[model samples]
Target chain A: MTSLYWAVADGWTITRRDLTHWVRQPTPIILGLLFPIMLVLMFGFLFGGAIAVPGGGDYREFLLPGMFVMTVAFGVEGTMIAVTTDAARGVTDRFRSMPMAQSAVVVGRNGADMLDSVLVLAAMIGCGLAVGWRWHGGPGATLAAVGLLLLLRFALLWVGIYLGLVVGGPETVAAVQILVWPIGFLSNVFVAPETMPAWLGTVAAWNPLSATVSATRELFGNPGWGGQSWIAQHATVMAVLWPLAIIAVFFPLSVRAFRRMSR
Target chain B: MSVVAEGLHKCYRDKSALDGFDLTVAEGRVCGLLGPNGAGKTTAVRILATLLRPDGGRAEVAGFDVTRHPAEVRRRIGLVGQHAAVDEVLSGRQNLVMFGRLYHLSSARARARADELLTQFGLADTGDKAVKQYSGGMRRRLDLAASMILAPKVLFLDEPTTGLDPRARNEVWAATRALVADGTTVLLTTQYLDEADQLADDISVIDNGQVVGNGTPDQLKTKIGGDRIDLVLHDADDLAAAAATVSRVTGADTDIDRDDRRLSAPVRNRVAALVEASRALDDAGIAVEDIVLRRPTLDEVFLTLTSAGTGHGPRETGRE
Candidate 1:
């Protein structure tokens, strides 16, 4: 029990270290928050006119939840960069050498990233509202939609931490950062999968981001492609399962990678 | 012993980083692991610090086996890696307080410890500045301060002054000496022979993953040879004549450097050898500009010890 207490204490300590970074250098966080807002403005104003909603609804409303998912997905890049930087700078080794709990580093990182996700999600929601995006499904469903977005963020956090540990050097991290964009664009986040070719549509519809986007669109009472496919019909179920599956795989992998470092 | 390792071996795929490495550092003394790059100094230090497990070896730090009781060993040992490991975004004091918190000190204690370390490391004036704004030496001092938060029983410093300027290196050396004065056992790895000579009470000279030589700095220097006589002749043409005269007087082979018009040879008696060499060179009309007797430097000791195929020659000088 005492050990468990210290482990949590150590994890919180690490989390605070990251949070302190946020306080010391607010530019990156501000830029991260602004990037999604810029996307919202570009797509909502400049590009929303060209894009059509399949079910005949406001394009901004349809695009808002997708933007939220994209925001969460984009978080992988930040997490990866942070992790790799720490590893490269020998901060991770310092933590490993200390008597702190073995799990504390990752746990603290997850905690900080999750907290950052919450703040970003809230800011994005405000951006959504200012752009005339509204959820007709009332407060509870909106809360559920927000929860689904954070759940996806939580899952992708582990993926980021895992890849960060696996890939060495800043150059490799830059490549991975570039790779995240295609994965984000290939999903149903920006455009309906039905607009693409049949095979490409299937792949996007099955994307983990698609599940959360489709599910949150439903909970928000916003228009989506509303496909008749079984996977499209089960967006909420997949939203929960996709992140759980991700956590199941990458959590252990991240822990194992941290332990096996320099061995 | 505050730290001990025996037959520690670590193989990274086809390359062996450490092969049968062994060392022991007694309490409150600095043991310098002196070696050139890739000589397994860092690898040996890592194993003793409980950061890396040896493939085939037994090691202990602060009475706890590194592999078996890593957490216990970690509690007693502090490691400062080659690079400065403190966070760049945080201030110097913040980094120390964060590390102190990770060490499980209470909030107030962590804060107090941070203040104490910042002052001790001479970082108190810059304690509130973001680490990114600090100079390289200040960052390194902060790294050292972070490791000293718990007043660890054993401290592992891997190439602490590898890239610092001479003055900055002196700052780190001074800090290390203060730590030793406070009774912290330090296991320092450094490539600079002078760094070892300045700070190490004992040194283990590593080469190709093993201790090639180990002793006090004076003892290691003596292992290569005793005092030597050097002559810088006034005329370059006298180099050959001076070498012969010095060798004849010292009864040892002389090293002749025609470019510098210098000749040097090992001698048993410093004063007598200098006198005899000066007299013989003067008799031979060598036109000696200068002659002096000096002890063998640690660099020569290192070169002679680690030169390939000098197998077990220098090893005999190490503690058995």
Candidate 2:
């Protein structure tokens, strides 16, 4: 019990350290928050006219849920950049050398990034409201949707940590950032995958991001991709299962990568 | 001993970072691991600091086995790596306080410790400033201060002043000396031989991932040779004659510099060797332009000890 207490305390200290970074350099956080907002406005106004939702459903309602999922997915890059930068700077090594709990560093990183993800979700939701996006699902369903978004962000946290340790520097964060865009656009974030070629559409519909987007649209009582595919039919279950699967694979992988750094 | 390691080995692909490296550092004394690039100085320090596990052999630090009891070793030792590891976005005070907090100090105690270290390291004035604004020297000092948050029993500093100006180097040296004065055992690694001469109580000379030589700075200097008598003659024609005369007097092989019309030979007695060489060159009708006998610096010891013909590969002054 005492050991667990100290681990939490140590992890909280590192989280606070990251929080202080947010306070000290408000530019990056503000810019990061602005990025998704800019995307929402761009896709909603500039590109929304071109994107036709089937049955003439409201594009804003369909796009908002997908946008929330994209916002959460985009978090992977920031976490990767922060983690790799710290590793390159040797701060991670410094923490390893100290008498702190082994998991504290990663735990603290997840905590801080999750907090950032929450703020990001709040900002995107506010932007959605401004752009005439509304949810007809009651409060419980809305809460579940928010919960799913956070879970996806949490799972991506481990993926970012693992890749950050593997890459070992900030220079590669840009490469990872570039890869995130294709993943974002390939899913149901903008156009319904069904509009693509049948094979390509199947791949996109199976994408983990698609599951979260599809599930959240259902929870938000918004328009979703109308498909008879098993993945689309089981979107709600897949939403919870996909993040859990990601966490299971990458959590240990990330911890192992972190250990391998000193070796 | 605060630390001990034997036959520790680490291989990174084709390069052996630590090859049967051995070290022993007595309590409350600074032991400098002197070496050039790729000499395993950093590798050895990392292993001892509980950051890396050696591929072979055994090690103990601060009475805990590094591989088996890393947590305990970590508690007793502080490591300041080759780079300044403090958070760049955080203030100096915040960085130190964060480190203290990670060590499980209460909030108030952590704050107090941060202030104390800031004052001790002469960073009090700029403690509130973001670390990104700190000069390189200031960052290094803060890095050192952060490592000492718990007043660790053993401190591992890997090239603490590698890229600092002489003035900044002196500041770090002063701070290190103060730490030693408080009975903190230090293991400092450096390419600068003079840094070891200034700070290390005992010096370990590493080359090719092994301890080629180890002793007090003076003792290692003696291992290479005693004072050297350097003679610059007026004409290149007199070089051979001067070399023979100096060799005859010192009973050591003389190294010649044809461009400078110079020859130098190691000698046991400083003043007597200088006077004797001067008289011998004068008698041989060799017009001497300059002659001096000076004690061997650590630079010469490192050169002689790590030179290609002596032990390692072709001499490449790591500075270049």
Q: Lowest summed lDDT over 10 consecutive residues: which window, candidate 2 chain A?
A: A168-177
Score every model by TM-score: 0.95, 0.96
Q: Write the per-residue lDDT of candidate 2 for residues B127-232, one digit (tens) a residue.
A: 9999999998999999999999989999999999988998889999999999999999999999998899999999998999899988999887666666678888
lDDT of 1 by residue, B37-121 (tens): 8999988988887778899989989999999999999899889999999899999999999999899888899999999999999
Cα lDDT tens digits for candidate 2, A1-263:
38899889888888888788888889988998898889888888889999998657888888999989888888999899888888888998999898898889988998899999988899889999999999889999999999999999999999999998898665688888888889988888899898999999988999999999999999999998778889989999999999999999999999789878777
lDDT of 2: 0.88
lDDT of 1 by residue, A1-263 (tens): 38889888888888888888888899999999999999999999999999998878899988999999999988998899889999888899899899898888888998899999999999999999999998889899989999999999999999999999999678887887788788878888888888999999899999999999999999999988899899999999999999999999998998898878858
The TM-scores, chain A only, for the candidates as listed are: 0.97, 0.98
TM-score: model 1, chain A: 0.97
iRMS per model in Å: 1.0, 1.0
Q: Give the poorly placed runs of model 1, Cα more than 4 Å off.
A: B235-241, B308-320
